[model samples]
Target chain A: AQTVTQSQPEMSVQEAETVTLSCTYDTSESDYYLFWYKQPPSRQMILVIRQEAYKQQNATENRFSVNFQKAAKSFSLKISDSQLGDAAMYFCAYTRAGTASKLTFGTGTRLQVTL
Target chain B: DAMVIQNPRYQVTQFGKPVTLSCSQTLNHNVMYWYQQKSSQAPKLLFHYYDKDFNNEADTPDNFQSRRPNTSFCFLDIRSPGLGDAAMYLCATSRGQGGQETQYFGPGTRLLVL
Candidate 1:
């Protein structure tokens, strides 16, 4: 079974600054996917970014990005130019290729954007 | 825009009572999934339907059941509600399986068992 871990239970970032949420996973599969999902207070889970294990280059989506280190089994999310709207609970998830595609998720990191 | 929709944004059921949650999609995707998310925890997979084929997770309790009448709709039936069953139920959909395809999520229904 694959497991994802987000060590930080909560993170704080000042407006316009950057913050990184750490994530690590234990997976034997070489071909897999890593994802970061954001769930706001409203309880809607939104896709923040995703990274493919085979890709060496990190994935960037607007101000959200991921530092995917397959060798270290680490996948971290970086939020740049953070805005107040970025406050939410962020989760790190994993899914293997050619399978049920059921996501195994980390405990989650609650991000608080402050002025 | 085509999206996944879950009805009864909030549901309150008494203990031992049965409840059903409905999910519909306009995207016409072949796969629909149900997830249970407790407070401050990750959403756990309950089951999913690929077209009309049902797939339930090994850990999912038999107390939970599901129905997919057609391509656009799926239903989750909890035979008996317990306080432990109170949580947010999420519905999602994708075109196919594997890690490549993106799954779009619904707002989720918050269930409270009294």
Candidate 2:
């Protein structure tokens, strides 16, 4: 079984600044996938970024990026130029390769962006 | 744009009443998933249907049931709803069962048990 952990229950960031959300997971499989999802007040879940275990290179979206440490089993999300729209609940998820596409998610981190 | 769609954005049902939530996808994905999310908590997988095959999570209560009649439609039926079952029900779809495949989510339906 795979378990994802997000230590920070809440986080705050200033507009135009950067913030990083921490995530860790326990998985026995060598090949897997890690993902970060964002849910806003509207209750829509949006994919932020993802990283593959085999790929050492991190994944980066326009303003979102990730720091994936395979050895430590850590995958953190970095939000650059944070905007008020970035304020949402973030979740970390894990899944193994060649299995049912069920995702094990962390508790989630509530992020607040301030002006 | 092709996307996942969940009906009845908000629902109010009485305790012990049976309710069914519907989901449709235009993406023609091979997998459809149902997730339950409580306030301030992460979404938990309830069950999923791959093509026409149903897969239920180990911890998902037996009161909850799912049906995938076709490639684009899936339904979640709660036989007997309890107060604890009041939460957001999300429908998602993916292209395949690959670990890296991205799952597109619908705007979840919020169920309120009276």
Candidate 3:
């Protein structure tokens, strides 16, 4: 079984500043996938970024990036130039590679962006 | 654009009444999943259809069931809705290719038990 944990229940960031959300996961499988999902007030879940266990290089998408530490089993998300639109509930998920792959998600962190 | 669609964005049902949530995908993905998420909680996997095979999560209650009639359609059925069952039901789909495991989600159906 895989369990994802996000320590921060709520986070606040100034607009145009940067913020980091912490995530840690426990999984026995050597090869797996980690992901960050953003759910805004609309309650729609959107994919932010993802990282593969085998890849040491982190994943970056526009203003969103990730710091994946395979040894520590930690995967954190970083938002650069945070915008008000970035305020949302962020979730970290884990899944082992397979046909019936199911994502195990964390409790989620609520991010607030201020002007 | 091709995407996953869930019907009845907001559903209100009486307690103990059976309700079914429908999901359809135009992406033609081989896998479809149903997840239940409570307010401020993470989405929990209920079950999924990988082709015709149904995989249920161990922690998913027996009161919940799922049906995948075809490759592009899936349904989540709650036999008896309790107050505790009131939550958002999310439907997602993903194509299996090149170790693809990412799932694209729909807007979700918010079930309110009265």
DockQ of each: 0.73, 0.80, 0.57
Model 1 lDDT per residue over A75-107, tens place: 999999999999999989999988767888898
lDDT of each: 0.92, 0.93, 0.90
Q: Give per-residue CA lDDT, model 1, range B1-114, as digits (tens).
A: 888889899999999999999999999999999999999888899999888899999999999999999999999999998999999999999899888778888999999999
Between 2 and 3, whose TM-score is larger? 2
TM-score to true structure, per model: 0.97, 0.97, 0.95
State the lDDT of candidate 3 residue by residue for A1-115, as single tens digits. Answer: 7799999999999999999999999989998888998988866688899898899999999999999999999999999999999999999998886536688899999999999
Fnat values, candidates in order: 0.69, 0.85, 0.53
* Tens-digit lDDT string for candidate 2 (A35-90): 99998887678899989899989999999999999999999999999999999999
Q: Please report how far candidate 2 places residue B57 from its true position, in Å.
A: 1.2
RMSD values for the candidates in order, in angstroms, are: 1.0, 1.1, 1.4
Off by over 4 Å in 1: none
Q: Global lDDT for candidate 2?
A: 0.93
lDDT of 3 by residue, B4-101 (tens): 88998999999999999999999999888899999978899998888898888888999999999999889999999999999999999888622346
